[model samples]
Target: MGFPSISKFLFGPLVPVLRIEGIITPNTTNSIGNKLRKINTSRTEGLAVVLDSRGGSTGQCQTIRNQLLQFSKDNNIPLYCFAENFATHGAYYILSAGNTIYVNPTSIVGNASEPQADIDFSQFLLKNQIESRIIASNPLVNEYRFNWAIKDSEKDKKFIQEITDRISKLILGDIQVSRGKNLKVNEELLTKEYTGKQAINNGLADQFGTYEAILAEKFPLAKLDHTSLTQFSFISSYQWNSRFGKAIPLFLLLSLFSLKVFIKYTLIIQSYLLVSSQEEGQEKEKKVQH
Candidate 1:
């Protein structure tokens, strides 16, 4: 048996609960990836992800989804997802990676549509009397400027449409693959937002339940290790010690340098004020004597 297997055999089973909150970004992916890599899979009964995000970065969403799916497969552990408040856009994309998705009765699910590309700030800038300038080596780059008018750019429209199509394909493909025969709705219906009850009915989610209750029912014996995978806990334990170990000294040095500069400037200002006060007093005395 492996070291983790031996350890599990000696102790007991553990269920790792990872909470993903806020906007999904590269850092989110990195934090989750690092935690997954460090998990002792042999002892793990299953992996549970608690998602509470409004969604962000489609590319990051796909990357994180792939990582989660791969981790579950490689570890031979069932992956459970619990959507708390909402999981729209890229968050929904990541949510579809779960083997079994659980949601609260009021949870918002789905809305995996293509992002809107046309974001012209020209009107707003013009109203505020702000003249935005774009200076680029390539003229093609100017076409993408927020201040530039994009009313009649057929090429830009076509390019945006192509990108949206690809993004849609990737997101919808993953959802279909993960949900498989359980997914009841068509592609058109999948793009619409639904409540937790509606989600289960449409096969977007498996059950209407909270994280604690679901985990309690599913893995009754396994202890939930929620802190291990949390960003703050992980950083404090691992990153702070190892990653920032050498950098701490440098940080202190820079802080001390800043403090020294501040003190020198303060002394200079105080001396100038004192000299100015003395000069004014002498001038007033000379005027009185005259």
Candidate 2:
């Protein structure tokens, strides 16, 4: 058996360290949800969440935060959060659920503000001579579409404002509830971004530490098992597309070559099979004639 397997066999389950990196989409929620459900709570000593996201869908973030909180409460295990790079907006909301939130000295934290409304691409489309038509049952629904012109109605403005305000309040409320007395800053300050050091000073983060340090300090005897909802292969493909956009043509070329080779081999096999069948028929005729 491998070292990890051997170690687990001898020492029981290792501490599960789940990562929440990238945008908080429904996919993110589902991935984490499945992993959370699979955790062996009986053998698990503690859970650590590594957050490095610039925020995403508000609903998805809230869902994941709730799931983590519930898991910790139900299991009665310490849930620690380690913020890397940046954990802002919806990401910070999820981070707040941690019993203790740790950050690197330069880690960007906070930004519990209202969600940014969808960008108006109407001007860009107009400039590019693209006409986008939305066929909606209700005329008002056109205003919600991305390519629609900005609505002039006060009612529309108020409705949009209300949505953003409610979302901001929900996020702030959750952070306040989770951090409790530990939160020193006001709502205004909470909405602003801060470095890890500033975050600790403002009570946004508990301490300055990395994942390794926290694990060593908190779970000295326990082995560390890093868990991610996304598979390595999917992440690799995503990274390839994101980082090497220029290489896409090369990838497509290779794919075409592979397809061509497959087709060629398929034709060759088919021809061979057809020839063999014809030869067999000829043999049968000869045998009948004999």
What TM-score does each of the candidates earn? 0.71, 0.70
Compose the digit string of candidate 2's lDDT tens values, residues 1-290.
55434433334445778889997899999988899887766556788999999899998988999999899998788899999999999999989999999999999999989676566666777788877656778877635533345423666667777778888987898899889999999888899999999999889999989888878777665557686422121223443445457657987999999999999999999999999999999999999999
Q: What lDDT tens digits, residue by residue, belong to model 1 across residues 1-290? A: 56667645444567888888998899999989988987877778899999988788888888999999899888799999989999888888889998889999999989987675456666777788877555678867635633344342677667667878888877898899889999998888899999999999999999888879888887665567886732222222342355456668988999999999999999999999999999999999999999
Off by over 4 Å in 2: 1-10, 124-137, 142-154, 228-290
Model 1 clash pairs? Answer: none
Candidate 1: residue 186 lDDT (0-100): 82
